[model samples]
Structures are given as structure tokens and as C-alpha cells.
Target chain A: MRSVFRVVENHRESDWTHTIFFDREIESTPGQFMMVWLPRLGEKPFTLSYLNAVTVKKAGAFTEKLAALEPGDEIGLRGPLGQGYPPLKRPALIGGGVGIAELRLLALASEEPSFVLGGRTADEILFYEEFRELGPVHVATEDGALGHKGLVTELLPVEADSYAVCGPERMMAACLPKLPAERTYFAVERYMKCAVGLCGQCTCSGWRVCTDGPIFPASTVAQMDDFGKRRRSKSGRWEAV
Target chain B: MIPLPRIDPPLINASGILSYPEVFTAFESAGACLGGYVTKSVGPREKPGNENPVVVYPPEGAVLNSLALPTQSAEDWERDLEEIKLKNAKLIVSVYGGDAGEFAGVTRRMSRFGDAIEVNLGCPNKEPGEQTIMESIGQNPALSAEVIERVRDETDKPVIAKLSPNSDYLAVAESCMNAGADALGCGNTLGPGLAVDIRSRAAILAGTTGGISGPALKPINLRMTYEAYARFRCPIVAYGGIETWEDAVEYILAGAGVLGIGTAFMRKSTHEAAALTRDIWEGIQEYLDGEPMSALIGAAHRAAEGGDSHA
Candidate 1:
């Protein structure tokens, strides 16, 4: 299922982040991800910002190369993989940093999506203008440089029909009590090797993130002891989150 | 021959492929279509295995992995197994070791959790010294038998020797049988094969090389299964590149009593994996017509000897 796609656009959002759109599109759902490959550099999982686009941040050597791609550069891609967000009505989307990439599609699909975007400063808040076009947008920055001075959790909307949260695990954990478990969904990440679910590399609490979910309801997240606390390293050893 | 644990469908998940005890619910979801569930290779000590890019798919309809057996300790697995629920399926625990002593220690600790114990004598990725463990023991008849004999001393449950495909497997198979192995897992993955991403000029797998599975290993491992079964006339669990029902039929014709499928599971969901077993079983029944299906074991070999084709 791996195919090469030409980079149609490499939109540099910041010094550390870039959004790359491809020449082709696939039927992908929100919360699902793609394993993006750059020759010799290796493959890594990235949440799709759109069916045809992935927003990446240069966090390591591999992603550093991903940041170097220009228009017409080819990258290997496999998926719209793993389970994605289930349909929701009047969903309130919560995102932190670049993790907002996972929530963009969900926001676009909803008729009246409410977004609470947060980061350390205004510069780190992603997709603010894009989401404002879709629905009401709330902003929070730890530095008090945006709409709200405190955490995004402080700006939670109580009237939404459902909540779709994707961000740091601890932030998602904090949102659990303010939102209903049955109506809240979290798009989590892990060190995934085989996105097809064979390698057991992305297992958390007994659930294969690549198969059972990358998106899980808050109730399911409650049962996972390892959530926000521990994750497996590349060698399969459990390490502190 | 002492009857082994009944694997109702004769199709089981191969060791190291979605076989972690912590996720035994995966096996439950795959359902009654599976005759058995094999655990990842447990060892005396917890192993972290190789680094990332552990698995890769080449365009050749195959998979290469150098996971190097990242296993939890035997103690952790015993604790994990107690919490799992596998309805109506047998459990075949796969265990590996650094040496014969380590193998015995792990088998003694984990054997009680399994209906049968599969000694993983052939893992090509865990290279601790001059040779990988598979090359050290799996390729040597005496070393393979010694490990099996020590494992035999540890448990009363059926012991299966999972040998390597990269060596004189039939000779190793014969030795394992004599060492009191109850059944033969008629070959592990073949060749520490290499796949390179031509543009980067770097190996695709982080380990640089890994065991070859999927379609490429089918013919080679099938021939090994056929020969090993013919020589020992014992139960054989065939592994390597079984994707469709026809492949299952070919292995059964080659004298496999049980089939261990890993690569095919890569392309299927848990729900789809369950359906695959039933599909293959239905295909076998249709191909067998009205004749008893068990009568077809080693039918190809019999045909070669100029005897009744269905004998």
C-alpha cells in the first residue's frame, strides 16, 4: 500500500513546523495517520491535517529531513491508517501545539465546531485562522499572549454535543473530568513500527494503538494505566512518558 | 503418538505476530477460527530487542523484521497470562533463551500457562556473539537437540521445536524429534535478508538485515515442511508465507497438521483474521469433496511414491 507522492506544497508555518500537501488524495478519516518515509532517513508516523496534507514539526533527525523537502520532492506514504474519530455533532475540538493536526479534519466535518487552541505562546497555536473559518474559535496561551491567559482546559465549552481532544496526554487527562467520557474522544500517539498491527510496537495497556485505536473514548482511556504515564521505547522497554 | 492439544481449525497465529500475552484479547477477537494462540518468545530476562524501523515491507510481496525478540521476562508473562481470556482455543507458549540453561529456566517458569510449549530455537535477529542464536543452535543438530531435551525435562506438556529455515533444517528436525519434541514447527523465517532504500543507499531495516517472511519464504519452507514430515512422520506446524486457502492446502498436502500464519495477518483486521480461518477451512472442504480431510495429509508424498493419492 506504499506509494510515492510528490510534494505539491511545503508550507513553513514556523521555524520548527511545516505542512506538506501531496499531489494525490486518499480516503482518510480524522485521527488516522500516515507513515511518511524519506529514503535512507527512515519512516515515522504523522497525523494527517487533511486527506492530502500532513503537518510536521522538526523534533528529531528524521523530521529535520522532512522539513528540508521542497515542492516536487517525493516521499513514501502508507495509510490513513488505524481507527479514526467517530462521527459527532456540534463537537468541541481541543488541540495543543502541533497535535492540532489530528483535529483539523474532525473540525472541518462538523457543522458547528468549537475550537480551543492552546500553546505556550500565540506563535505556537496552530490552525487558528483555518478553524475560525469553520466555527467559533477560542485561544489560550500559558504566556497570556492570546484569547485566554490560562490552560485550554479552562476554556472548555459545556454545551457541545461531544468533545474531540488531541494533544499532550496529560492535557487530555485534565480534560477528562470536565467532559463526559461517553462523548469525549482522544487521539493518542505512540512509537509505532508496523501500522498494520503485527509488530506489537505500539501497544498501550494491551490495546494495539495501530489497530484498536489511535482515537479512543475517554472511558477507554480511563482503563489504560499506562496512558500519560508510560510508553514503550523503540526497543519495547516501557519508559516514562 | 500422544494426542496434542486439539486446535479445532488447525490454523493458529504464529509466534511473535500479535501474540503478546498482554493483548490476548486480540486472539479472542480472532475467534474460534483459530485452533491455537502462540505467545511471543519469552526469555529468562526481559529483552529490549532492536531499535526502530524494526519492520519493513519490500515490493516483493514480503515483510522483513529484526525485532530481535523484545520480550518481557517469564515472570511478567505469567502474570499477564492469568488475566487473558481465550475462548475455546489452545495456548502454545513460545520461549527462547541465551543458552540451554536459560531455555530450561524459562520453560519451567512459563510452561504451566501453555497447552503446549514451543521452543524458539531459530530467531535470526538476536545476535549476541559470533553467530545469531539460530545459527548457533538451530543450524546444529546436537545443539538443537540439547536445548529441546532440557526443555523436555521442564514440562509434561507437549514440546515443539521451532527450527530455522536457513540451515539443514531436516537434519535439525530429526534431532529435535529424537530429543523428545512432540511436534515440529517446520521452520522459522528464512534468510537474514537485506532491503535497501536505493535513494538513501541505506538499509531499510534499522538492524540492516532481518528474517524474510511473506510470499518469498513459502516455497522454501513448504519444501522443508514436506521433507521433515516425510522423514519423521510426526505432527508438523508449518509457518512461512501462507496467505490464501490454496497455500494452506499445499501445506496440508505437504503433511502439515497445523498451520502457523503471521504475514497474512498483517493485511487483515482482527475481524477479518477470524473470517480468513473460516474461508481457508471452507476452501479445504470444497477441495476435498466428500472425502475425510485428514486423509489428505502427506497426500503429495504418497502420490510421489506411486501410492493412493489420498492416502
Candidate 2:
């Protein structure tokens, strides 16, 4: 059942991060995403930062419009789409930049996980307080304004048996060598339309990221040669990300 | 009655668009109102496909893609098809092979799971060989007929030939009709076009060339459907840039028995697609009033001939 829901709450998390809470009750799990539509404005997929809520960053044309949206505004939403992060008993949740939005909910849902959140600057770090409530939080900012001053992967405990990781492809790629391929579950992001596996735009290797993953086993990620180095733009051209 | 199958709405999700089994229920619930869903083209073996930038959308509501027909083997697709349940919608499994024997082999194995078998004769990005199979088979009447005849021998279920607009599609359609094809899926995508980013001075897609689809391809597809209808007796499944109710009506008027929606589905949500279907149905009803649905099927051709040509 898809429907148009009114914005109940919109919060500015940082200079660029904004969270919008919808009136709609959509059942979803961590690592899944929603196709947010603003009618004539257009539609794009956003990872769920929390249940029925999307944390957006002002990046492109659609996100710029999404940033300006306020309470009482109506936006069309469909999903809780794609594969989600599975529940893990003891896991490490690692996120980088806006990719942290995909991990926030998973951190809360997990039993007691170590959260490694990374950003370029302290101001860009997201959901720190919320993640802190669930488990120990490790923060890393490139500027050294936050906890550990380096890549979040630097803060990731090398000893964790299993992991849930999300972030820019490079960040995930950096973490890949550290985590056991059989134990890590990576939530990948890609350029998508339909977000339903039909468009073929979000394909990584033979896998449709929209369906086969947004969440992929470490073994699957290990198989994709283009995982960290290349990504397709809206124009469908592959360029170095 | 659209002739190919017993679907009420006469609209279908185009091949290679949305083939995920878990999402079909959402599309149906969202009002996609499709009569059938065509799976992506499956072949004899697994193809990893081309690298990044497989699909791109131009400003004209058109999408260019050089996906290189990436697919799992027919055996894998057959297994996948078993899990997909679309309630009332028919499953039209699309298959592709480098040669007629492979086509027959794949069709024979996949036919039991589908309401129909659609032979993909339109992919534009086949690697350059002594002869590219799609062009060699699709453009030549004898070769096209032979391919269809082989597939026809494999299945009693309806056989649909998905023809390419790049070739002499009308001849292909005519040959397919004569070769025992029950229907024709007209106009795959248009042009093996290239897009280069001026900033990087590099090709947009990893493949460097892809088929152009969307509204920009609609005019070409519409004309192809019109010609196929005028030339052949088989049902025509028209696709290209069908995005609106008016677009749907235009295809029907131009002689498309079943309409395929692709790029438009990319732009609109499932709810919007459903609404569009309802609106098109109502619009068709209003346009027909008490006239039989058949009256509008080839009305343009009848008008062009100044009489009922079929009669």
C-alpha cells in the first residue's frame, strides 16, 4: 500500500544533514531504503535513518528541493524497498559521511554494537547522540575535531567477529581488507531509478544493488572489481568516484 | 481482447525494466495494472554485462543503455520464475541466444513457466562478430523466419518476436508472422548512440554506445507499430516512449494491440502508474463509448486506406 504522507517533523541535523519524519507508518528494517517522491520535483531513493524517517543531505537537484521541504508538505513515498541489514548478535556498525544515515537505525536495532561514525569535520558527524544511547560510540573526523582524527575504519575494532558497514564506496573498500569477507555485510549505494531491479542502473557486476543488495555479503563485494574505484553518474557514464 | 493473451488492461511492463520477484506485488498493488510482466532477456549462459554507466537518461525523457544483455543462464531464470507470483498477471519470459538452436533450447526449457515466450531480436550491443546475431537474424526475412520457426517448434505457448527498430522491422514483423509467431513486440530501443562528457572528454557509458529509449524513441516506435500493423496480421506489442494515457491511446490507434511501458515507469511511482492505467482505461472508454474495442485497434490504418483494409 503506497500513499502520499504529510511531513510531521523536519529537523536540521547539521549544516547539510536534515531529517524528515512522515505521518505514514511504513514497516521497514535497517539497511533498506525508500523512494521519496515530490511529484513534479522527481523521485530518488534514500536510506532509512530510522523507521519511517529519512535523513537527507543537500547534494543534487532533488536533495536540494528535499532540504527546503517543511512540515505539512506532502511527498509520495513507496518502499521500505530492497534488502536490509540482518540482525547480528555482536557486530560493529561503521558509517562514513551521509552513508551513516543507513547505519543509524541498524545501530539502534542491534544488541550492543560498537558504532564507528566518520565525517570530514565534527559538524558533519550525524546521529551521535542517538547511537550513543544504544552502544559505545566511536567518532572519527578527518579534521580531528571529533574522537579519533582519521578514517572511521581506523577506529573500527580489528577483533570484531562480524560487521555491518555502510559509507562511500572508498570508505567501504578501505574497511573491506580489515573485515573477514565471510562475516561482513555491506550496504552499498548506487545510481538507481525504479529501485526495483528493473532499471539495471544500480547493477554492480551482475548483481542489481537495488535487489540483490543495498546489503551484500563481504564475499559478493570481494567479487566486484569496480566496487571502490568506479561509479555511474545520472547520465549513465562511469566515472571515478 | 488484445489477441496475444487474456489480459484486461492491455498494458505490460517492458522487458529488462523491473524483473525482481519480490517487487512484483508492490507494482501490482501500486496500480501498475499491467496485463503481464516480461522478464529481462535471459540467454544460454551467464553474462556479467558491461561495466558502469550501463543506463543514462537524457533530457528528452529518453534513456540510453549499453547493458550488453547481462543475464543469468536460462536455467537460473527458470528457477527464479518459479518464485514470482503476480496474482492475475501473465508471465512473459524473454529469451535471447546467439543462434536459433540455442533460442529453441532456451524457449523449450522456459516455456513451461511462462504464459508466452518472447524472443529478443533487438539488443543493439552484441559484440562485433562475423555477423551480429540480432541484425543477421532480424533484418533478413529468411533468417528471421527460421529463428521464429525453431522457437515455434519448441513451444505450443504463444511465441512473441521482439523486433529491433534499427533493422527493416516491418519486413522482420512480416517474416515473424509467417514463421508462426503469435505476436510481435515492436521497437526495442533506437540507435546505438554515444554520449561523451565534455568535462572528462570521455564516453558516458562504459560500453561507449547504447540503445536510446524513452519519449525520444516513441515517435520511431509509434511509426514502427503503425507500419507493423499495416503490414502484418499478427498482434503488435508496442513499446518505446509510452509514458502517458495519450501515448497509450496513440499506440492503440496506430495499431498496437498491447502497450509496453518502460522509461515512463522509471519516472513514475507504482501508484502513479496505476492511476495512469485507470485514467487510460477511462479515457479509452470515453473514446469508444459503445464502439467495440476492435474499432480503435487499427483506426488510423483504416483511415489512411480510406476503408477497413482487413475487411
* Model 2 per-residue lDDT tens digits across residues A1-241: 2356888898999989899988866778888788776654556788878676898999978898888789988776767777887777678888889888888778778777878889999877787887787777889999999898888888855456579888888899999988888889998878775465556556565356776678988997998766887664543335576
Candidate 1 chain A worst ten-residue window by lDDT = A230-239
lDDT for each residue of candidate 1 in B60-141, tens digit (9 for 90 to 100): 8778988888877777677778776777788999998878888999999988889999999888885333357798788899
Best by TM-score: 1
lDDT of 1 at B290: 79
The CAPRI classification for model 2 reads as: incorrect
DockQ of each: 0.44, 0.08
Which prediction has the highest lDDT against the true structure? 1
Which ranges in model 1 have alpha carbons more than 4 Å from their true place? A3-27, A38-41, A50-53, A58-61, A64-75, A86-89, A176-184, A217-233, A237-241, B1-3, B30-32, B126-130, B282-293, B307-311
Lowest summed lDDT window (length 10), candidate 2 chain B? B126-135
The residue pairs that clash in candidate 1, if any, are none
Error of 2 at B13 (Å): 0.9
lDDT, model 1, position B143 = 91
